[model samples]
Target: MISEPFANKKTWVHSLDPRLRVCTAFFLSCLFAITNQPVLAACALIASALLLGCSRPPLSALLRRLAGVNLFILFLWCSVPFFTPGTPIAKFGPLTCTQEGLDLVWLVTLKANAITLLLIACIGTMSASLLGHALQALRLPDKFVYLLLFTYRSLFVLADEWQRLQTALRLRGFVAGTNLHTYRTVGYLFGLTLTRSLDRAQRIHQAMLLRGFTGRFPAFVLLRFQRHDFLFAILTALFLIFLLFFWNNPFFP
Candidate 1:
């Protein structure tokens, strides 16, 4: 459900041409990755928020997704500072955090948030199939594009299979715990799931063959670019370029 929310939303971001959106997201991602300055990183994060606002996805869902991402980021924040070497800022027993480590943590957090926000706004506002086609349009390798397409399609199928397995287990009076029986049952479940997945893959391949699915995916819809799409892409690029230029200006030096 969360995966395909883009199809239901009719915002300005969703209205932009997917090709331009993909390009803009790619450029922004590169920009975010290369920048090391904390101020520039924060700016990137702000830009992501602004983009998300324009897309207008459900706020609660957005927060939930962001919270899940932050869990991993929290781990990085906790562990990264302990290993990085620099001027010690705080001591906890034998372990201490360096100023450089603190800076690294902040940079990682900012970059993560910025990229996540940009993706939700830029690429997440469009259907996966269309996005795949847009990638193809951009001359990305067909194998990579199709890999993305198949992966997206199969995730839901795998999730459904997992849910069914859980339901069956529940109906069979399965009670999960840290006991030996629970562990053995889980092992069986994993093995069975893998077997079923292999079977499903074979069946899917046969079905595709019957339907004349060549290695290339047929275009379902033509992508059209409007004046607004170009305008949006241009404006976004200009703003990012300005920020990149400003970050290197002598004021900060």
Candidate 2:
């Protein structure tokens, strides 16, 4: 139930201009994607971790976010080593892993960790509503921005509905086991969840129409680029330039 864990923190990251944060994230992501060097990726990941530390969100929240990132990364570790061809490093039964494949795994894991940390540190500080407005200001597609906005709000609503369905099942003495009854009941729950989601979406659309929600969503609080934002921009630019330098340098081999 700890949704949007970083949003409420009274940190300098939270005080940054949402638009600036979004742009920084975009650029950092580009840097991650463009670089093939695992050393550079590892450096970026470390920097991202330090940045996240500065944000000062609760330790539990930090761990939770990292756990989610690593879970997906676990799949990459599992598959990349076996398939990518190079000199064999080790073998498990008949499957052989190569050094090149292991390198690829490192590249993926580092880049993903770097991006996730940066996203949590930068974008996670802002509320979904503010982020939507920021995205609109950045001239991202309206449909995508609105989708992000609605998805953020609706996630909690749908989760609540799911909990209610679980409660209803529990009241009817539903016990989860590997059986036909359990499978049927689980399927029913899924169908009901989908049905409720569709119904809610329809109602939400109608409500928006009634409230004069056109294609454009207006921001109540106008975002201004402040002194701190300027400072952040300067520092971020310097760091990115350093990353560029490192990429071209034959330091780590």
Candidate 3:
């Protein structure tokens, strides 16, 4: 099973309607993505951090996720500074670091972190099944929702099949190494896994058809918008308005 550390939490964030969380995360990400001003990005980042704090995610897990995001940002820092055209601030032999490049990368870093934190707080606190249901409730395309739910289910099946294959290989005294035989064995293992997955998929489809599945899975728990949800919506609206106001008129250089 996929580990969902944040999903089972009883925090206020987890209690909010999944649809509301999804919409909030989407709009916040869009707002953060298009903004080029560092001050606006910084403010957004601070807001996202507060949201994440409300979600009360495990600090260790949050740190791990942030580390992964920053690794990619680190790559951007390495390449973007040298190639962007602007007034040169620093030089290393033929490569020159420009002020514009540094500013651009910094804005990106802030936006990326802010959006990531926001998503982790909002979307990450729900199970994949709940997310799919929320998307369906939000009137997303039926095909897209079906694809997401199916893909998520299929990942577990694939992982199980792969693990069974690995166990078989281990039982047969297979030892991995930097050798042609190991490479061939690994390739054959992947081919067998694919073949088995295809067969399993066919079987599953036939079973679903036998059960009269008409492409729509019913949600067991109906989503209700409570007073808290209304309050959340109001607060989020005010926050967005504040961001917009500051976005146009920054108080700092």
Candidate 4:
């Protein structure tokens, strides 16, 4: 079991088949992309929030994982009103904030937040191996899937090494502060990480070849299509049909 928030075993989300999660996430994403109303978007966000809580992933884990992205979201929101010009809701010389711009800001921000949550809801509960297996079963391109698998494995491996490098930096009084020297140091570290990642990739390919790695990866395990999956699929189809119709309805603004 994954010890992290998304790696839980208790929630209904964890119990769900991987394919269901993928479909649900993908469907919600499509819906979010096509719809542009605040209330409707809020509904989608609430649905995602429900899944997040239902999955029982750690709140702290979600917050931490989303921290860097949310920081950017905050910066984006702050800049929108100033740079986006429209009929003035408020005016400060050259900076006239418009109602449309503010509305647009909230619309994008909420939808983006919902999108992130929806993805986290899927990935947090799934192992990369399981996801790869799902891709294979779904008939995704074999070459790309193998590439994804190798990339996923390398990510964790490199993450461990990166942590070690960070520790070493700290031990030698390499503070993570903004300075020309620090930026240069980090740039060098990034370059080294990429180099090491390539080396590891080469080693893995050699090892796989030695172990009789063929042109194509072995087929993924089949997940049984349970009654629950059918139900979910049906319900989701209905929900999406309704959502699309409603989005197109004149009363839906």
Candidate 5:
């Protein structure tokens, strides 16, 4: 089964309406993506961190997620500074690192971390089903919502099928190696998995039809926008306004 470690937490952040959270995350991600000022990006990162702290997710899981995000940022750090054109700040052999590249990478690092943290604080606090319902409530296209919900459900089935295939391979005395035989065996395994997955999907569709599943899924729990939700929205709006005001006016160069 897929893990939802943060969803079970009973924090104020988790209690907010899922629709509000979804909207906030979407806007924050978009804003941060286009922000170029390092100071503004740093402030956004701090705000995101504070929101994440309010959620109080498990420390280990949070660290693991952040580590995964930074791993990609680390790759950028290794290459971006060398190829960008600007005044040279450092050099090793024939390679040169420039101020412009360093600044650009720093901005990107701050924005990426800020958006990721914001998403975890907002969207990650809810279950997948709740997210789908929230999207529906926000007037997203029915087909898109259906696709999201179905894909989320299918992931668990796929994981189980992959595990079963791996077990069968082990039972047949298959040992992995750096050889053409191993490569061919792995390819066959994937092909068989795909075939089984298609069959399972057909069975699932038939079952859904038998159960009278219409085009839309009825949400069991209705979400309400409470006073606290309004308060949260106001605070987020103010923060966004502040960021916009200082977007190009960095406090410190």
Candidate 6:
């Protein structure tokens, strides 16, 4: 439920080359995965938090909106012990899940969440158009690229329509109750939304074809990077190296 700060005005991160942003995100994810010690991963997580703080959004905004999904991320750790087993740590009335499994749980949870935070940070810092342009420049398949672009574009349209529908329903005093009518109302909304979405997609596709779209999205490189870009990239690499090295290599553990 966290409000998206990604819609912020242009900042330094946004001004960088899209390739740098993408690479930074990938590098952070790798670092998070390589580190398993909770203390070390916690430090990495704190660093990411600081990075977000530097992005200039109020902390309250992220908590009020993003905290719920953040809680779900915390729960992702619950799965590790149920699947992985070794020596016992705590007995939950009778369950025999081990410390090793729980260590894995911490590892998985922190790794996934740290990466998610970075991804969110990047998405907020960079514009969708810039991201599309970057991917296109990377020589991604045109069909897939255009599909993603159009899909994202269509969402705002559909979302606006949905808001209008909700207002209309509210004005008419339509209410859901605990009965068959509730199910019927849900079904009606679903049908209406689906039909509207499909119709809108068809019209958009026809319009694109009319505009000479030959299964390719136009690519425009917006800006280029400088030596500073490499410096930031090297710093990101060093951060990853530090996190990964904090834990003793335990593949043979």
- Maximum-lDDT candidate: 5
**Model 3 spans with C-alpha error above 4 angstroms:** 250-253
Q: Decide which is better by lDDT, 1 or 6.
A: 1
- Model 3 poorest 10 in a row by lDDT: 244-253
In angstroms, the error of model 3 at 83 is 1.8
Alpha-carbon RMSD to native, per candidate? 2.2, 2.4, 1.4, 3.5, 1.4, 3.5
How close to the true structure is residue 207 of candidate 4, measured as C-alpha lDDT? 94
lDDT per residue (tens digit) for residues 25-86 in model 3: 99989999998789889989999999889988998889989999999999999999999999
lDDT (Cα, tens digit) per residue for candidate 2, span 22-88: 9999999889877899888988999899888888888897888889989988998898899988999
Global lDDT of each model? 0.86, 0.88, 0.92, 0.77, 0.93, 0.71
RMSD, candidate 3, Å: 1.4
Higher-ranked by TM-score: 4 or 6 = 4
Per-prediction tally of clashes: 0, 0, 0, 0, 0, 4
TM-score of each: 0.89, 0.88, 0.95, 0.82, 0.95, 0.80
Q: For candidate 1, lDDT tens digit of each residue in 1-253?
A: 1366645688888888889989888999998988788788888899889878977788777888799989999998889998899999899999999989989999989998999999888888888888999999999999999999888877777777777899999999999999999999999888887778778988999999999988998888788999898789778978887877887777643
- The TM-score-based order of candidates, best leading, equals 5, 3, 1, 2, 4, 6
Better of 1 and 5 by lDDT: 5
How well does candidate 3 score on lDDT at residue 178?
100
For residues 44-85, what per-residue lDDT tens digits would candidate 6 score against the true structure?
A: 677777766666655675665467656776665565675577
Give me the runs in candidate 1 sitting further than 4 Å from their true place.
Answer: none
The Cα error of candidate 2 at residue 171, in Å, is 1.8
How does candidate 5 fare on TM-score? 0.95
Weakest lDDT window of 10 consecutive positions for candidate 4:
1-10
